[model samples]
Target: MSVTRPVAAQFEAYNKRDINAFIDCFSEDFRGYRMPAETPSTIGKSALREFYISNRFNNPELRAELISRTVLGNKVFDHELIHGISPTPLESIAVFEITDDFISTAWFYFP
Candidate 1:
C-alpha cells in the first residue's frame, strides 16, 4: 500500500485536533525531529502524544493547511501553511517516513 494514507490521515487528525487519531498514524517507536537538530525532539508514541496534547491540540486556533504533497517510495513530503500557533502564518515542509503502514520517523523543516 501507498505511504500517503498515514500522512493524509495525520493531517486530517491534526486539523481536527484529534490527539488519539493523530498519534495513531505514527508507529510505537516513532521519532520526530525538527530540521537542523541532531536528535529527535519527540520519540515513542507516548512522548509524541504528550507533546502534541500540550503544544498543539490544546491550542484551539491552531490549524495546518496543506499546500502540497509529494511522495516517493516510503517517504511523504508535505508543504504546509500553519495558522494560529504564531502571530503570522508559518510555512513548513514536513517529511514522513512510513514503515509497516505507520509513520516511523518524521522531520519538520521551517524555512
Candidate 2:
C-alpha cells in the first residue's frame, strides 16, 4: 500500500467516527506525540483508541478539512483544519510514519 494510504484511512475513519477502522489503520505499537516533543502522549493502539474515543469520537460534529499534503517515502505530512472540537476551528499539521502498511507513529502540531 502507498505510504499515504494509512494517513488517508485514519482521517476517513475519524470523520466517519468509526473507531474500529481508525484503530485498524495503526500498528499495534503505534505512538503519537505533539510536534517538537520527544515524549509521546499516546503509545500503543489501545491508548490511541482511548484518546480518539474520548477526545474525537464523542464530538459528533467533528470534521477535518485537508489543506494540503506531502508524501516522502514512508512519511505523510498533512495540513488540516479541524472543526467542532473547540469553540472555533483549529488548524494543525500531522506527520504520519507508515510501516508495514500501518501507521507506526504520528506527530501533531498546532500553530
Candidate 3:
C-alpha cells in the first residue's frame, strides 16, 4: 500500500541505515521518547541518533518491520517488530508526530 511521503521516506531511510536521510525526515528541533522503564523521555534527534547507533552496533542484525499504521491529522501510529534483528518476536508501537514540513517527532512504547 502507498502511504504518505514522509512515512515512506522514514522507513526507507531507516532500512538503508542512512543517518542523514533519517534525520532529514525530522525537523531541526525534532525529539523522541520511549517508555523503557518509566524513566525520563529520550529527547532530541541527536540523542535519538546516538541511541539508534548504539543499538545497531550492539545488534548488528537489528531490523524493524512496520506491521500496521494509522494516520490521523499530523500523527501516525505504527505497530512494528523490533526484535527482528535477533530474529526474535518483540513487538512495539511507534508514534510519529508529523510537522508542517513532514518532519517528525517520534516515540516508541511496548505493548
Q: Quote each prediction's TM-score.
A: 0.98, 0.96, 0.77
Q: Give the deviation of candidate 3 from the true structure as CA RMSD.
A: 3.3
**Candidate 3 wrong stretches, greater than 4 Å:** 1-3, 36-40, 84-87
CA deviation > 4 Å runs, candidate 2: none
lDDT of 1 by residue, 1-111 (tens): 788999999999999999989989999999999989999999999999999898989998999999999998999999999998899999999999999999999999998
> What lDDT is reached at residue 37 by model 1?
99
lDDT of 2: 0.93
Task: Encode model 3's per-residue lDDT on 59-111: one tens digit a residue.
Answer: 65566788998987778888888654555667988778877766556777876
Worst 10 residues of 3 by lDDT: 35-44
User: What root-mean-square deviation over C-alphas does model 1 reach?
Assistant: 0.6
lDDT top scorer: 1
Q: Candidate 1, overall lDDT?
A: 0.95
Each model's C-alpha lDDT?
0.95, 0.93, 0.71
Poorest lDDT segment (10 consecutive residues) of candidate 1: 51-60
Better of 1 and 3 by lDDT: 1
Clashing pairs in 3: none
In lDDT terms, how accurate is model 3?
0.71
Return whichever of 1 and 2 wins on lDDT. 1
